[model samples]
Target chain A: MPHDHHDHDHLSASGHPYRKDNDGQLTYWQTMEIAIRELMVEKGELTPAQIQAQIDAMDDRSPANGAAVVARAWTDPDFKKRLLANGSDAAREMGFDIGPMHLVAVENTIDTHNLIVCTLCSCYPRNLLGLPPDWYKTREYRSRAVREPRAVLREFGVDLPANITLRVHDSTADMRYIVLPARPEGTDEMTAEQLAELVTRDSMIGTGLPKSP
Target chain B: MTLTPGSTVRIKTMSPLGHIRTPHYLRGKTGVVERVLGPFKNPEQLAYMVPAPTRTLYRVRFEMGHIWPNAEAPQDTLDAEIYEHWIDQNAP
Candidate 1:
């Protein structure tokens, strides 16, 4: 057997920092990210502290943010109108900064349902919904969503009536989309805060629906 | 280029050999200008980490049947954001 040369404080034999799991082995993409980050820091393009801060900032968001926007839209018709008219501004009203990208809120009506997909990439409304689920970044979801959306929805446990036309939005370029699913039938009496609890991340992505109360 | 919302437009069919935002499935597809999404720096050039001029982007809506002939519901639709440079005159 080979000698165990792993060290925690110093670089391993392969020049990579020893992680908890792998014996100094890193995936290709992970290695690339590490190399690029190190190069940027060495060139003074960005400091390691700045990169860490950016990562921390990304972690600050979650699906609950999107749920809050959805719940507010369901409770207030005026807010719903504003959200449908200008999603970025409406999100701001709820204290969510969506950055520079343009956001569009698509409403799911009795006759129509909206589904969002980034066929070319996994571009998502990260500001409101946080980072996308792992499956969202997979090639399977990207291609299947554009080709057979209903089938994909069924897998996610969202079954719609055949009469209800399904509209699929392909986010090809800069625009990011979020679906405002129709409120569940029995939620008429629920408060906005209570309704928000029923909203799931998948619902905003158009793959699921709010829990029925 | 400024596009009037609701005006019918056709996506030009051009397969450039480089990083392009327009998907192959939407090439030569006809759609209506849903809204102007404003101007932004060209991502194609940004990918190279170079300074690029801003380009207008538009949200275009297309009928499901137009994109996929065998679409289950004829009334279904699909919307996509396309750069202004990728669009041509309206289809007659």
Candidate 2:
């Protein structure tokens, strides 16, 4: 097993030692993840070339895709209106899904900003982006994030306006949230590709805003 | 409830027995034991590591209000399967 450096979700009840099946019986389910991999190789689930084809068919998972959609929104006034009206369909029009959840898109005007946290698990928009960072799933993060978002963001060196309303979106199930930051000044002359580069993951997470380059 | 000196109350992330889906967010925060729900399997089954490890089941609760005070939504209760080892009985 790859250990993978699992998170520290240890409860006070976690003091017990790991129990190993003394008789030595490995449950089939225990081996299922690897089993599927082996089966694919043995059964020729796809040829080496075909595997690439499958991968291509699947949409890329990353914020880059979201950046593209936001860029389009910035360039096209009509698209921005549509995106605000129908988040799911507007994102679909951009050839994307929120990835993990179908939560709505709410814009942050001059007065309000939004942030997201998965109080349950890291139920993020996987389709919109690839794997989340390692810190996202840590127990310390999960426990303390929403309770003290400003503090957490400060750890990342983010300084938010005290007067601006901060909304914390907790992802319970498949539902997700995306922040539409107030477009920065002086970027009106930039191209869509240029705009895409400005929208960082932190900005989308509601901790920061897109910067002018 | 084993009464041992020097224990504290906290929410457990995984059950030592039975099938449970413990959220990563609630582990290690202080919560009162409303009442015992009885023994259960460790769904967060550490015993899965050992072929058959003995584990007892209990129902533990943490207040949703305690988790998020400003929660616009109203859900007063949160319950889950708790293994004996996952909790420590601390002073109220």
Candidate 3:
């Protein structure tokens, strides 16, 4: 018989393991969330299994998905053309299942640079890149990004030359944006998979550049 | 009327009490339409869970100096998605 490794102290009276979050004091919002979730489950509107599966799906998404797209664009001209023309369709073609997010791809060129922010709220391309970094949602970043993009980019270690025009995109409504960072030079020999290793989440957000090979 | 790309338009300055997507800084500022982003349900109405009508959204590109008095770089630009109702086509 297989030995059970369950720790007695971690188990409740009902023999169920205690969730880590259950230890904290329930705030008003947490209480409300529990109430609503229970009500929905009781009313048969949703199942506990369904909710867990949904969470699992969200957890599965990460910046790696976006890195692959960026790498593909770097290597393939036709894919890059389609990606620039229609970001949502191109991502769908790659089997990303980004849902109804109207993604717009802004390219970083030799003379132009692109940055994205949501001044109204923290609207990000969560489907493609997973949850945004904590700083991206802060009031400081949201306001500074549009007002002084050059200064903001400098803080992120991306100092643009005076010749390069900085373009800051405020995702106010309907559409989401993803920056197609300029492909680093001297990467002509690298494969798409190897190139993907260099695409960081910050690079996609236009706050930083891809890692040098 | 649908706004064409490259047409100059100004965002109307108004502070109605409700959930609004138009940023306060861009109000009364003029910009050129970068592209027509098609129609979307009015977020102001959708926020209240009401029957929202569709409104055309345009990507307007504004000069940094035009939007701010002490812009770090005047030549740099800012682009934002503005709804049809917030844009005035008759701006001089």
Candidate with maximal DockQ: 3
Predicted candidate 2 versus true structure: per-residue lDDT over B58-79, tens digit per residue: 4344445566676432233343
lDDT (Cα, tens digit) per residue for candidate 3, span A133-201? 889999899989999888888899989999999999999998999999999998999999999999999
TM-score of chain B of 2: 0.54
Question: Which of candidates 2 and 3 reaches a greater TM-score?
Answer: 3
Please state the CAPRI-style docking class of candidate 2.
incorrect
Which regions of candidate 2 are displaced past 4 Å? Answer: A1-35, A40-59, A97-103, B1-92
- List runs of model 1 lying over 4 Å from the truth: A1-32
In candidate 1, the residue pairs with backbone N, CA or C atoms under 3 Å apart (3 or more residues apart, or in different chains) clash, namely none
Q: Model 3 segments beyond 4 Å from truth?
A: A1-22
Cα shift from native, residue B7, model 3 (Å): 0.7
Instruction: Give the TM-scores of the predictions, in the order they appear.
Output: 0.86, 0.56, 0.92
The CAPRI quality class of candidate 3 comes to: high
lDDT to native, each model:
0.86, 0.60, 0.90
Residues B1-92 of candidate 3: C-alpha lDDT, one tens digit per residue:
76799999999998899999999999999999999989899999999999999999999999999999898889899999999999976677
Measured by lDDT, the strongest candidate is 3
How do all the candidates rank in terms of lDDT, highest first? Answer: 3, 1, 2
Sort by TM-score, top down from the best: 3, 1, 2
